[model samples]
Target: MKILVVDDDPGIRELVRITLQDAGYAVAAAAEAIGALSMLEAENPDLAIVDVMMPGMDGFALTRELKSFKDMPVLLLTAKGALEDKERGFRAGSDDYVVKPFEPKELLFRVEAILRRYGKEEEAPILAGPLEIDRQSYEVTCGSRTLLLPLKEFELLTILASRPNVVFERERLLELVWGLDYEGDGGTLSVHIKRIRGRLEGLTDRVSIVTVRGVGYKMEILP
Candidate 1:
């Protein structure tokens, strides 16, 4: 899973980044709230770790904004550990809160707990028109035909098919399907999309991957 760390403290940001990265998570860091907001789309983070005290926008306000913008869960990290501060964090839509002097293991545990609560541990089968994507089996079936796609192809298709007709930004898709550390260009993504389209062509014509011109791609289910 991917996590975004938003903090003004350089030391805190680096520490959290290293901690999460060591736990096998893709980490993205932002120095402040504005930068964090800007990275939201491209980062496509599953969760956000935000500091309470910020210059422009505080963590509580950012939590509200983040919750409003997406269904992503936010974990507020701050020095404040009072009962009222905790209540305020919850009121502001934070999924969880961690005090500044927290142990690295504790933070990881909390992150895992929140993700499990969000159902990120397991995904259900997705049905888009005639296509049925079984995430567990990594199989796509249309009618009587079954298409066994490559790992990357399957993940890419699954991401698009999960939200039919919703345009996925190219950068977002790359980060989701590939990884935060992917050094490749858009050509790789284009090629994968092309391959998926070719494989799906023989299985069914009802489902399609539509290019959104300069934006990215979306899955379309035709009647």
Candidate 2:
């Protein structure tokens, strides 16, 4: 597997490189967001491990941008263990999150686990007109241009894409994507959907999340 490791800290970058290389995987390293984006254009790596905090772009932004091109599994490494941080990671479209001061073995295991569970063979990209989704890599492509989508937006897209014309009540989206056991601000769901639509703007004539006339919401695919 070819992996891209992006982090501002040289020590962390080296640690990831050495560990993955020892495990027999091709790895690429980038210290900043611009470098990472450039490397992505050239390498087309199988997976990416991103650090949440950085000088400017940050891991969240990177994950969202990368989602436009490839569904490559991303494992976010961050010291912030707060729920908001984790939620932010998920919202940015990361496959998994790992807190800092973690064992290398643990990180490797989590990466392997995600790859195994949602392996390459199952990741056929989904295309709905201008929007494209790579199930395997979790990348979204719109025409030749790709849009960066936060993790929740990606999940919400996947759910909606699965049914196309099917209407999923707002509560259903909350339960399925956010998790039935998850407890957060209830308004967060609408905000997320709205953001997703904004990213997908101009791709279609109507809203993806259609109001069900006082019922809930449904994904409206262009015919």
Candidate 3:
């Protein structure tokens, strides 16, 4: 998974970046909130580690803004560990808070916990417009029609439909669906997407997989 680290302090940014990178997560860092917001689309990070104290926009404001922009989880890191400050952070849509002068292991633990919670939440059936994706049964149902897909196609559709309108990068999709060791070109992904698209075309018009040009693909839920 990819993580975005936002902090004004260069030292803290590097420290967090190294910590996450060492744990096998792709890391991106920005010195301020604005730059972090700008990186949202291109980075498509699964989680964001945001420092609460900054020059222009504080972590609280940034957390709210980030939630409005994407569905990813946010962890607020700050020196303030008081009740009111933590309440404020939580009120601003932060999934978790980590006080400064923290142990790297503790930070990593909290990150894993939050991610686990999110994964559990997504374990339920996903309803995207007219499509219903059941991860358990590996079934895709569109209205009254039940569409069966190959293993790769089903996994790809499950990922896209689970997060409607979220742009999933091609490499990320490959890793999630085809496994990290899969030695395949982008053409394989394209072929599978084409097949899924063909299946959806015959089933429903409200849901579609949109090719995002240089990016990858996203499930678009049309009205």
Candidate 4:
């Protein structure tokens, strides 16, 4: 998971970044909301950790804007731990709230909870744009339509859709889906991708399986 941390305090920003990174999450830090907004345009981080106090816009306002316009989850991190502060955080559209003087383990737990609730937990339904891959039911849907795909194709799509815009190297995907014990040529992967692409054609306008020549592939969801 990728988390963007927004805080005016350099110490706090570094602290959060290191904490999340140590917990095996990709992280980016922004000093304010505007910088966070710019990062959102460049890459779609899974969630954002926002500070409640900043120079131009407070975290409440930023959370409201992100929830209203961007439809993204925000976790408010601040020193305000009163009951009313949490209420305000909820009203501002924060999915989770954390106080500054918090245990790192507790923060990780809360983050996991929010991610699980949103179907982003490990092995949950992989959602990206208009596509959803339900691992439980082994079903794939794009837009309003459900697609029937071969086992290999479905697995391939699941891997890509689970982490949208994250480039997966060919070897890495092969290891994950086909297993390290399974011996297969690169053509096997190519064929599977082609089949998946064929099934996805015209099914959704937002999803695109992009090939990064000589490297790997990534699923891009265009707005």
Pairs of residues clashing in candidate 4: none
Report the C-alpha displacement of residue 86, candidate 2, in angstroms.
0.1
Tens digits of lDDT, candidate 4, 1-223: 7888999999989867755754457998889998888778677788888999899999999898778666777889999999999999999899999997766656766887888888776665677787888865778887678877777788789778767787888986776567556587999999899887777775876788999999999999988
Ten-residue region with minimum lDDT total, candidate 3: 117-126
How high is each candidate's TM-score? 0.55, 0.53, 0.54, 0.54
The window of 10 residues in a row where model 2 has the poorest summed lDDT is: 120-129
Error of 1 at 12 (Å): 0.6
Provide the lDDT at 174 for model 4.
Answer: 76
lDDT of 2 by residue, 54-122 (tens): 999999999998887677688999899999999999998999999987766677668778778666423
Best by lDDT: 1
What is candidate 1's lDDT per residue for 33-141, written digit by digit as tens?
Answer: 9999999999899999999999999999999989998878999999999999999999999999999777676787799889899987535577889998996799998
Candidate 3, lDDT over the whole model = 0.85
Q: List CA RMSD, all candidates.
A: 10.8, 16.0, 11.2, 11.2
- Cα distance off (Å), candidate 1, residue 50: 0.5
